[model samples]
Target: MSKLGESLRALRTRGFTPVAARSAARSFKGVLACKKGEISVKLTIYDWNFLSYPHIQVLERQDFLPELMPHVDVAGNLCYFAPGSVTLDRYNPATAILQCLDQATAILDRISLDPHYRVEDIQNEFPAHWEYGQLSLPWQVLLGEIKPNTIKASYFILEIGDKKQALISNTPGEATRLAGALGANFKPSHFQCWILRTKSLPAVPQKMPTTIKELFDWIKIWDHDLYGKVQNILSQRDYLKQSYMPFAIETPVGWLGFGFDLDRIRREAYSRDPKKYRQYLHMKGGSQGLFRMAIKEVSARFVHSRNLSYEDLQNKRVTVVGCGAIGSFVAQALVRLGAGTGERGILKIIDSDKLGPENLGRHALGFPSLFRHKTEALQEELLRQFPHGKIIGIASSAFEYKQLFDADLIIDATGEEAVSELLNGLRLARSSEVPVLHIWIRGNGEAVQALWTDSTGGACYRCLTIPDPNHHRKERFELLKNAPVLRTDGCRAFTPYAVSSPLHASALAIDMICSWLQGSPSPKFRTRSVEGADLYKLRNHDPSKLKSCPACDPT
Candidate 1:
């Protein structure tokens, strides 16, 4: 089952009723699909209040549930309209209409199967998302569901010029009390009409208003009900009434705030139970840590799953040739994305050069690590970030390296002709079955070439690029060193004028890695660049295949 499906089933296993679970799952699925690049009907949020980015982020983390609260102003600013506040402007017709349509659909779906189903009280769940001033007087299905004995109403505060109007009906005395509770600023003149519904009305009932005070009284009742529901949900979940410490060092980025006391959490977790503490740090956002404290938190829920485990890299050895710009980025991604709670795989780094300022724009090495040899610098950085992994560094040229054939996978980032020739020669010499990913970061930095070879009938570099046949007979060593380079013909320099190309290259390389992991479509073998745009070949393209090509010809 898909992760989402599994999660839905888990929810069902929890206390949620089948109807509630399925209902929530359907809505959550719609939201999840949207997040995963699916398109849907554009939702126009009305003149309701808006939440802060951090709060919105929390919603995103919690799975995008609909919220009910104050409406957003027309300017998209969240408005906390005071009680008994008056406004002649109505909800924006477009957004309010859309919301009503959606609510209507959900209501119909609820009742279509069971005609007797009651529209439960519509609780104002979260803050609103409406534009205030721009929207005119328009009405919407204020509340959705119904339950026995009572019907919930949506209250709207109308503002007109300097005067305010409160619309809703309950009783005159109660309305007067509500207006008085709003403070001295509340004026009777600012008040307008109201809508009141009794038990005798149909579900699609009509609104009957007898007086302004009654409407104001009904508004107060509905507002209080909405607030109660919100509190109920929060209380049920035992969510910390306050947000997580903004400066909590638990999050990777939390260090940006008041500075997290990582040592504190570390010490706390360790002193109690060492193994669990280690798992706490690696469980993602400290879920295990929470469990240690006996707190039922849900921050790091999905980060410790098997699908995300380093199954591909576990117990497998890989060599990353050339600790340069492209090489460092690829290595970092692999380390972070592949390493599990306790890393075990070995990642070997081979490069002879040291870090230089000229390479800073592209290289992952920091300014502090300048002048350090590439292999040593990369190894240190990797070890520092991923203390659990084993990183090996070889500070020597490819040809001089003796252990070239021992690795399981060889990733070639060395943009030198000698390295490629050495790999090809090593494969031929040892009859090595190691798969090689020969990656070439184009000079323009807009694209990268990955020549994947399994040497077991899968495509090899020789099949893609033809080496001169005649030169292999006599001065093979000399010809290999002087072979035609990739930089000469298709090479384009990434001038300082166009620096964004490196970023593009980084993203493409990461995408390739993800695609490879997902077993989806891989990138083209050789991608051509035009004015910095990348294009790839779908099928194998053999430009140098002769009727009797020596290397790839069938025996």
Candidate 2:
């Protein structure tokens, strides 16, 4: 159990009555008083061990207190305060001392950045705290001290109209919204007690602290100036960076693009540092990355075109290679999605090998068709299902097709490394004239890689994947030479068909065909890895030069 937990139980071991402690807690509410029409709050002391005083600066640093006591009541017991004797009021008095202490303690956790802190260095060297006198003492700061008791105090300021309004919001969400509305910005530290906004603010949020390295500098600098008073930061720097730094959320990059009347972040920054603002002026504020563009276009298309029907895909010619797990699903999805269902349609099923009992689990062909060649069996099934749609069966490997007879879209659905290499070569060769859609299941059966390459636009598969020059260079070349005939053995025993592997490959094929038929953006190359979700384009690849690739390079 935690040390705090153990200490709390210790209080129970002592002879303290629940009623007496509760009464004492309740009686100490003299410090709390709300205006007649304002929100009512209460306070009650559950036990003596609950009382612990904190420092003001620390409280300011940890700005979570107001949420704990959202409203102050007329009674001694706070409606939102902690389970202890305490009260907070706008006024001060002797009897209200306990009330003040109670309310202050309750808000300490909300105020202080660190509950456990020691102050050191009272001299001019560390002057930030001199305003508080005998400054830089090691103690837990409280929220009440960091921020005055008045709710009206200016925690933030913004120019809403003709006047500059000082804003001391009760909540962070409100403060942020107000800051955005008034064309004001705030540093992270300024957010400690609600927020006090002004028309003038810093260029960057205050809490960001210029750089991540500032923490180290602060520790070293403070240590030298406040030698014996503060804790040594050297030992704790790593822990703080790892555990605490991330929790300090920075301001939103820029005000929301809601077209509000508030001044833009750049305009406000320009007033402070004209040169820096000029440099920043070139930095546009919008997400324009490839993925973002894809999402936006897709969404817009979906919204604009209300009648995109499956019937539109009727006369499309699709060539599907590799009748393995993915090949089966690809064929199934194509037909279902209206590729080869009726007249004027064609679906070519290609595989140079037969199906075995081992492939039954994933193959579309049934047990009755086992032992038969995969291409013939699938073609028979397709004919049975859609007698009018023309079905072509190529009982040979992809390389055997000296030229893909006139396919609107050629799909390579095989997941073999050898198959991928072969298709890469073919794709590079035909990229200029015929567009190829290559789909393959990754090794783990978790994801699939799909690439679309045409002679007109985007990079080909070779451009996406270039063999390493250091290792296995000769072996890769030899493999490429034997590619046409090597698939006679079919997939090796190690690469077996599974549910997920084929599903991913098939999904990618559908995406490829959709992009082709509708002129959608081409699929990216780095998306080939099963674990990679973030897509990236290969910039270093050159498909035009065959010197680097023996199989596809005509030169």
Candidate 3:
């Protein structure tokens, strides 16, 4: 007998009996008794090496109060272990299997008997219940706040692409625009959908409703407000006779949707189609079935801020004033944070430099961008990666464009003391409310520092520096034990730093941006130092204006 088989034998006393192999699947069927009584269990060795989890399932889906069970998928697979929650002992497969089975039964028992636990589990894992499995479609999602006071159903476009996947959208002209941007082909046909929103979760039930009758019944039982809204929308004469009726309902976790082909219900060939329905008495359904459209939310807002407590930059006008090593990372992070997605959202990159062979060693752009204008190449790269992102490149000096300063926020990643001073001079000259976030790496990737300043009055960029007769650049807080080494390749002098520094600098900048978005932008300046570095101590707190600074006065 194999080790897995021998292990199954040890559980015989607990009512496990070896089941004959059906195809490649090996399993032991057993019974586990809890406060809610006994439920059937099947433990299968999914991986002989025990590198992956064992497939544990509850076989008694119909019997033993299945309606109240939580964390059970459509196929009765028990979700006992969340990935990264526990690591399996690869050396001892027998003990690891035992531990997993013990936890599975314990979790199953707890949810089976405890109503409060079941409710919480069901609410937290709502999407699993609505799982569409292999048929899941690529759909655009927006968790854009739907005001509670707004009682009417909103208009949304459902487009089916050439590959037969669908996208749900509220953006005007989004279908054609997105299709072109994504390089996807689509037909002329599209569906109109009305998705009912709710701030509640569905109660644990005997499988997420596989039919239309059960869908309404399930919603009516758990979310009364949403149920009433659905009925009100259904009662409207304008919506009754549509040949194809597609609808959706939102739970707190995510959204699920489907469509009913009202014309197909009468056809015997289409009689068994899950999405076939008949409209009788307008609000009444003479024939009803279920076809689930599992939504995959790909909207910039959802991608960036789904389940996040703080706001994202989806609607913000952001400008990154450099395309050097640090700025490239910042621009990419900004895109992911939704900097250039919404109607008013615009992300502009400004730089005069061209991508050279030397810059590619540590910069985001590689061989493809060689000799291209930094701004134009970066713009192309960002757009290619996120086709929906709105980005503009100004291949010019930061000092030339007055419009560059007019943004919700500006980030300076030049890491040049001269540019910082120039920006500080600009800051002193203007009373604009827009804040400037400055981030840079210090001395051979030893540490990263970020400073956020605005007209609200605190430290400006010049405050961090003083005259350094010994050095070419102004001395700032003396961060390194040894001076940063200057490199020259038969050309102009520049500081040499690795890629990691700029990446860390980018992360620091994003953190500051997040803080600003969160509305309490404190600790305006922060520092993060790497280990084994020749570094001086640094403080992470808002700084007061330097009295000796010449640029702060702007005279």
Candidate 4:
């Protein structure tokens, strides 16, 4: 006997009888019946493979109370497992099949007992079965370019008597002209219109509706009176004819065009119960029928880009002193985190050096940007990736940038003691201090550190470095206290480290900046390195603000 045959025999022992069976190598089909319900269940199992798991589905619909159970869709397909959760063990097909059957039976039994369960009971799994409204629109309508911010516009309805689909036009003039072209009988003034404005992109719905009433319920949750308002607007038009309400939803994924038709809904209600036709007519806000709405999803890149963090980052102005390895990565990371190119936030990159062949392996910019000034190249690269990001690249040293004093936050990635001292002096001299973050990699990428100081009088970058008579200025970390320096043939000595080391340092710097932006208390100094790899076995370090710092005047 085949493995399926043995499984069927086991199921029979558990009070399940096979009404019909099909034996094949490629697939298995059987009609099963159980004492749980008088309904005949057809199970079709596809062959197991790496790409597709071995799973069975009920082909024939069963008589079960709807909307009372989790994992069941409107089509009656029971979701045995969530996607990517687990793979079926083809070797243990019988055990897997029995386990699934047991689970399904338990779920059905629960539904039979409690058909009116709370919707919140299945909140976690609600999104898996959510059904979005059908929306259809022409490509040209969505392709039309508009401004970034919100704008008020009119939605013109184009539906006649009792039609299932309602056409809508965003262009009011085109809608009116089309009405005129149709002839004198079609009065352009009589057409339904809505005054709508672009709203911030909403999150993709987690819990969608399977029934029209469920759709209306979901809409009510978004705006309590919106359903009633939409109904009232539909009522103003001829009830006998198909009327449409314009719904333009800006979601994180894209723009969605939705149409709500009242006439078709009423017709559906009359079809479902002829005796309730009078009741349907007398119902307020057209709540008697299915609240089905059409949605047209348009693919737009920027739709999903605006959120709370993105909005906050948009309002910030940041300056990075060095557009080299660490600075370039930090700048790019900031842009990806919602720092836009213009009014949203300004990202000013300052560096006097040019991108050379030596920098390509460690730097964010590549061959295309070689020989170009580091700031300009990085800015151009960032703009190419994030078109909306407001980035300014200044090919000058941080000392020449006087606007740094006025910035919301300044970052120094120069890895130079002279530059840190200059910024420290400038910060102390100013009455209103701008927050500064200093990031650098130590001991040939074995260690990475980030120091942050804000207007609230935290330890400045100079405080983190003690005046060293032996080696000039040295980090407080014991590992770097007496570290040897490598000499090169030329004036410039190469720092031996991988690309990942600078990136790691950049991430730490970004974390500090984000914490300050969110109004959270962050550590003044932090460091991370691999233990016992290249230097000291210390894995992490977090130093407190210095009490005796000349730069911050901590007496």
lDDT of 2 by residue, 260-318 (tens): 11125544544444444323322332111110000011111122222454234566777
List, residue by residue over 1-555, the lDDT tens digit for candidate 1: 354354345433422222223322232212213322321222222223322110011122121222221232332222222333423223232233333334423432332333233222211211111112223322221111111232222222434456554323223333343334333133332222111222221121112112223322333354555324322322321222122111111111111001011345444434534444334333453321110011111111122222464234544577878888767777776666543222345778888888987788777788988999988988887766654456888988866888876776777777555577568656755778876667665544544455555555544455554446564433211212222224322354333313344444445555555555566324435443435243332333323332332445534
Best-matching candidate per lDDT? 3
TM-score to true structure, per model: 0.42, 0.37, 0.85, 0.66
Choose 3 or 4, whichever is better by TM-score.
3
lDDT of each: 0.42, 0.43, 0.74, 0.58
Off by over 4 Å in 4: 1-26, 31-56, 67-77, 87-118, 121-224, 232-245, 248-257, 260-312, 341-344, 468-471, 481-491, 534-555
> lDDT tens digits, residues 1-555, model 4?
486677667566655544344464333344434345633343445563323443444555445544334555555566655576667666666776666666565655555555344243354333232332122222222212233453324433444454223334444443444344333122333343343332332222343443345555665665545556544544443333435334444433344444444556664555544334334434553443333333332111232244435334665788889988898899888887656433456888899999988888999888999999998889887766655556889998778877877677788988776787788778777755677788888877777887776667656777776666796565555556445456564788876678998898888887876677677636667778755645654444345556566676557
lDDT for 533 (candidate 2): 31
Give the local distance difference test score of model 4. Answer: 0.58
Better of 2 and 3 by TM-score: 3
Instruction: Tell me the lDDT of candidate 3.
Output: 0.74
**Local error of candidate 3 at 521, Å?**
3.5
**By summed lDDT, which 10 consecutive residues of candidate 1 come out lowest?**
291-300
Off by over 4 Å in 2: 1-311, 341-343, 401-403, 427-432, 473-492, 526-555
Candidate 3, residue 375: the lDDT equals 96
Residue 31 Cα positional deviation in candidate 2, in Å, after optimal superposition: 62
Greater-lDDT candidate between 1 and 2: 2
Q: Higher lDDT: candidate 2 or 3?
A: 3
